[model samples]
Target: MKELQQLLKKFFGYSEFRPLQAEIIQHILQKKDALVLMPTGGGKSICYQLPAIYLPGITLVISPLIALMKDQVEGLIANGIPAASLNSMMSDSEQQQVKQLCIQGKIKLLYISPERVKAEADWFLPRLDISLIAIDEAHCVSHWGHDFRPEYTQLAILKERFSKVPVVALTATADKVTRTDIIEQLRLDNPQVFISSFDRPNLSLTVRRGLNKKEKIKSIVHFIRQHRDQSGIIYCMKRSDTEMLAEELSLFQIKATAYHAGLSPQKREQAQDDFIHDRVDVVCATVAFGMGIDKSNIRWVIHFNMPGSIENYYQEIGRAGRDGAKSDTLLFYSMSDLIVLRQFAEESGQVEINLEKLNRMQRYCETDICRRRILLSYFGEEVEKDCGNCDVCKNPPLRFDGSILVQKALSAVVRTQQQIGIEMLIHILRGAARAELTEKGYHLIKTYGAGRDLSYVEWKEYIYQMIQLGFLEIDYAHANRLKVTPLGTKVLYGKTTAQLTKYMPPEPEKKKTKASTGKKGFKAQPIRPIESESVDEVLWDALKQLRKQLADRESRPAYHIFTDDSLEDMVAQKPITLGDFNQIRGVGQIKLEKYGRVFVSLIRFVLKLPKLEG
Candidate 1:
């Protein structure tokens, strides 16, 4: 463990390990199978990368995307680690060079796609001295996961071929079901599981509801103006939406671009490249744009429409604040978006699970409780207190004892034999005289007319709350019927009570003022950059510019040189000597010897400090 810590500082320059990284690394070093579930930016890569450096032979990393592999390899190389990636994009000669390096034991880490492993593992495994196997994005292997890929199923061959080699599987998003599936599919031999806390305190979560298209556009533009000169991503649901939003944002003098699978490969690559290089400040893209993006300086992420599942939403939001700096995430959703997403889920092959996930996501957007609490609970983690960083915590809603209301709804579902969906259930409670109610004999249920005093919209809101609070469950497989969970049964039987939020009508949209559309636009409005109070703004900007210059010279992303967190550390510390600079979070011995002097000199110049003696 002591040697591991030294290697960590020597290579990655971290003084201490994150929560489970050290334990996970130790397990891997013992040549045991492990499954790790850590949030994005929680340093999952180090669990495998650092151990690979210490292990005698090269490590095989099966990744999902070419761009992701390339980004990681570049970052590793920048840290003076010997790493290479083999993908379809590389020439035959390039692939052969990486292979030769592996044979000659020159490469410490080698990345390849699951498809590559499926195609050539038989030929590839026999020639190399393999010490470890790391599967990234391991959630893709599960059919229940948000991003299921058929190619990943072929990875079961690894355990069969390399029975003696230890395997480590890692992902940013996975519920219990997906975690189990990953183990079963990969045939890992009783792998030790490590689940890090899913909390990201540095991110502020907000959801804007009841906004129309024009209103959403205006809100987004206002947000961008406040966060100008920082990198952000606006996720749209469609390719056309991306292009239209990009064009609209550009009209406001924002540096924005569009990215989607519909565009030519070259165009998509160029757009991604420009964003990574800091030549563009925003990218209006679909879900396809961000899966492979490893940019650590993304200051914010905006969702133009609600994502279909909580897993997808969590993963997308995880892309922001990777550097552990304070970042903002805004989600704008409306009923139309939910309707469209529900239709898509209904049409998909996995109708039941997809609808279940979609319903959960809708609950996330509509919940009046702590948003972070809901997210964490969905992943099987329980928290005692509400997170004060979300919109709900900042602006709490009114709550009332609605145990009777919940009993009324649950009784209605029971009277209807749990065979009705939400709409029918609501109608029965409100005593609506529909022919189906009459034919089904639901209008005569004891709970009928019990909730008639509440309006249709009010009843709808309460029932939805009941579903979200786990007082009721939606049986999507059985015609979207409502069933009482064990918790719901407790309320139905009067064993417990329920507290529900008071139904609040949506506020009417305010009339637009001239300033909203003035020629000078939002650009002329002054807004402070979203950053910590202690960080030196001017010095931060200067360091960013310097990092960009260095990245341009090396043709790599600015973060490959130093993450925003590292730069902020430097700014706060105002290091003027080589030793002081080396204390920065990301300044390893290699980086210290490579670019420490220039950075130290710049810091001295910027802070007006004395020059170091020769």
Candidate 2:
């Protein structure tokens, strides 16, 4: 255990294990199967990577994307760890070289995709002395998971092929159902399940309701301007939306690029590379763009549309604030987006499950309660108090005794035999003289026209609230009809009351300038560096510049060289000697030997201090 900690500091440069990382690593070191559920940036990699170094044999990592594998391998090698990747992007000779390195026991860790493993496992498994297997993105194996892939199911063969080897399946987001499915599908043998708290306090969550296209663009522009010189990602629903949004951002002189599967492989790779290198400030992309990204300095994430599920939203937002710094996440929600997502869910093969997940995501967007509480609750983690960081907690909305209104809606559903959806129910409540209502005799119900004082949009909002409150549910299997839950029955019978937030329509977005022009009309604004009270601004800027130079010279991401957190540590500690430099967080032995003196010299030069011997 002491050696493990030493190796952790020597290789990964961390003095302590994050949460359950140490326990998970120790269990794996004992040659046992385990299931790990930790949030992004929670040090999941270290659990398997560290054990591989001590286990005396190579650890095989099954990853989902080539870019992800590449990033991990690059970061490992930069830390002076023996790591290599085999992917379709590599040539035959390159693949052969990596295989030979593995056979000769020169490489301690080997990363390959599930598809590659499926094709080569039969001939490949027998050649290497396998110590352990690490399955990343393990949620993809479960049909109940958000991002299910058929290829992941084939991985069950690993336990069968290597009966004595330990396997660890790790993921950032998975519900109870998905976790169970993963264990079953992967055939893990009595695996120890370790679930870390699914809380990312550094990320501030906000949802903007009812924004028009122009208003959303304006909001995005304003946000980017405020967070100038910081890296961000704007996620769109479609490929076309990515391109259009990228162009819109560029019109304001923001260094933005478009990324999606529709683009050529080279173009996608270039976009990713530029973003990782800080040559691009933002990447407007579809969901496909960020799954494999490992950049640690993303200061914000913007959702251009509602995601299909909370899992997807959580995973995407997890990309930001990875360095555990303060970051922001903004999501724009509109009725049209909800409608589109519902249609997609209905069209899916798993209609009931998908719609249920989509409804939860909708509730997340519409709820006036703490967003973080809702997010944590979805992952089965109980929080007694609201997270003070979310917009709802920061600025709470007005609430009123809405028991009468709830009874009115529930009574109408009962009068109509619960045969109506949200739209139809709203129409009936608002006394709309529609032909379908007249044909269905809904206008004559006793509760009909009871909610006529409220506008159509207000009623819609309230109904959605009721759905989120568990008083009502949408049955996707039944023509998308609304059904009263047992909770709703209580409300109808006056057994319990409910509190509802007052519906406030979005204010009109003030147009400051033309869509194609900047805020000052054509002249682009200069990006201001982020400010911190504790950090010395001048030294921080210098360290970033030096890090970027080293990154470009080595052809690696700036964060790969030294994350922003490390830079801040340097600014605070102002280490002047090699010994002091080694004390900085993330400064491993190899890094201290490789780039230690240069950083020490920069610190001394920037602070105008006299040079000192070690």
Overall lDDT per candidate, in order of appearance? 0.88, 0.89
Give stretches of model 1 more than 4 Å off.
399-535
Instruction: Name model 2 segments beyond 4 Å from true.
Output: 400-535, 612-614
Candidate 2 C-alpha lDDT tens digits along 386-415:
989998988789999999999999999999
Tell me, by lDDT, which candidate is best.
2
How accurate locally is residue 93 in candidate 1, as Cα lDDT from 0 to 100?
Answer: 96
* Cα lDDT of model 1 by residue, 21-136, tens digit: 99999999999999999999899999999999999989999999998998899989988899999999999999898999999999999999999997777687678899999999
Q: Give the worst 10-residue stretch by lDDT in candidate 1.
A: 519-528
* Global fold similarity of model 2 (TM-score): 0.83
